[model samples]
Target: MAQQFEDKFRRKFYYLRLSVTDVCNFKCTYCLPDGYKPSGSKNSSFLTLPEIHRVVNAFADCGTSKIRITGGEPTLRKDFTDIIRVIADNSNIQKIATTTNGYRMERGVAEWKEAGLTHINVSVDSLDPRMFHQITGENRFHQVMSGIDRAFEVGYKQVKVNVVLMKDRNHHELPLFLNWIKHRPIQLRFIELMQTGEMDDLFTKHHISGVTIRNQLIANGWILKVRENNDGPAQVFVHPDYQGEIGLIMPYEKNFCDSCNRLRVSALGKLHLCLFGEQGIELRDLMQEDAQEAELISRIQMQLQNKSVSHFLQEGNTGMTPHLASIGG
Candidate 1:
């Protein structure tokens, strides 16, 4: 693919985290810990489907080959599957994926897979019913579990379980989580808490290191191995006898910014260059006003030039930051 979008640091941008909607079914403690309910952006504030395509096409034209549809629960959007179809039909895009809360799988998984969905990552912090309810402020544990099971039953190229490991919260259940997935083909990933302000205080109270998790896995007879060509941030490993592999994402311990290859466009059309970033260029109005593609690309290029080498979260300060929902986490 020809290169078009490169940051000031010379990082070629080929991945997009597109938040199709800001509405969600549940507010997880780590995501919306403060239970903030921002007044809805005017309906006109969000881009129409055509607008979404224009921005996507601009990025694709500029060499973006991967697009992940995220949400406040993207499935909540009446046209969620259509977004997948649109990106898949774009010949410039090579892969399509989603980070879903996993409630609508039974209704649309096959359709989405047929639409060229290549990967799915489900957020499942706990397997225990009580803790799951406590953490998410809802009683949808069984629903989420069934959704994950259904995802495994599907024929996608990759399906992953995203576990946010926090001390005393879901960290101790690592063994049980692994045992539960011992017979499945899904990848089990334990993620360190991202200090993305939504969980401000909770981060310090429950944070767990990926290194500690790594040591425990080694101590428990799990051997370390590497994927031949995998280069996404997760430190992937596999046990000789386990049916599925494991991953540990140490955002705090490791700096993935040097190789960052993605950018995000929020539901309201803000261009976010980094997850923990405080600034973004406005693009929604340009889209809504029917700006020329050249203008759109120019504005996008400006934001790309503004991209920083690293997010301050790497410094380990747990102050308030962007809300994961609105920021397209």
Candidate 2:
């Protein structure tokens, strides 16, 4: 059976963000915090490579052409490159990307690009070494930069740097970061801090609006030249004299739900229709229980209709835990 994964709102999903592993190397204050340990899910079993392939195949059969592998750090997995290889080998999957912290990227970028990784989104909080260490709780500032350089050296088509801007934390870095990236070819995206219920206090203290960021850029004489990737979350802009484009991911200030067209699968195989949705189908259990591939595929397709129209992720409504690290954001 062939079908498009669409909900009642007729949002056709073609992108899947698969979190290959829940394990991470760095302990960021905002994402992981101090003395943080993820409260384990009921089914804590991670998907094997074969199981991951089956999930990818199922989604591919349902018309998922773009897949982004995410994790606490995707490189922590033993077969990270092989995972991309398997997806690349699939004729149906057209685009393959990954979002990582760039801890081991310098050594792995060449292999990942060779394995069909065309785009990469690395999390780089600030250009200042001390601020970077303060934000990520790691002194690997130079190493992360080196990783991005190597990624460019390998000739990746799109190398995006994701920056989570906060009020007192790194809001001041907006101009500094922009100045540094003005000469580089890397695409920089400043994502608003997501309010995970458990971290509401931190969110209250740190959340910065993208509108303020934009206004600040304009005040600094930076021009917003063009907007591209209408389907994606980033509002990309280019300065006249800059080499790279800048992106603003303002989820709190903007509504991207109506145009959303993606699904997320956790490392343990829970299918998240939307990032803020608390409950999701235990897809791994369903896969293990259903002996017939047709039955599994049919069930998955059936649930696509039940996918929520919007995430309902307003400030006070979020309480789902295990944090973004576990969710692969």
Q: Judging by TM-score against the true structure, name the best candidate.
A: 2
Give the TM-scores of the predictions, in the order they appear.
0.90, 0.92
Tens-place lDDT per residue, model 1, 200-301, is 678779988889989987887787666322145677777777777789888776566776888888887888887777556688766644456667888888
Clashes of each: 0, 0
How does model 2 fare in lDDT?
0.80
Give the local distance difference test score of model 1. Answer: 0.77
RMSD of each: 2.5, 2.4
- What tens digits encode model 2's per-residue C-alpha lDDT throughout 1-329? 36877788887778889998878888897888663465576667677777788888888888788899998788989899999998888788887989999989999999999999978999999888898999899999999999999998898756899999889878887668777877888788999888885687888889888888777767766666553221357777777788877888876653657778788898888888777776667778555532555665777778777876666665455636547887788
Clashing pairs in 1: none
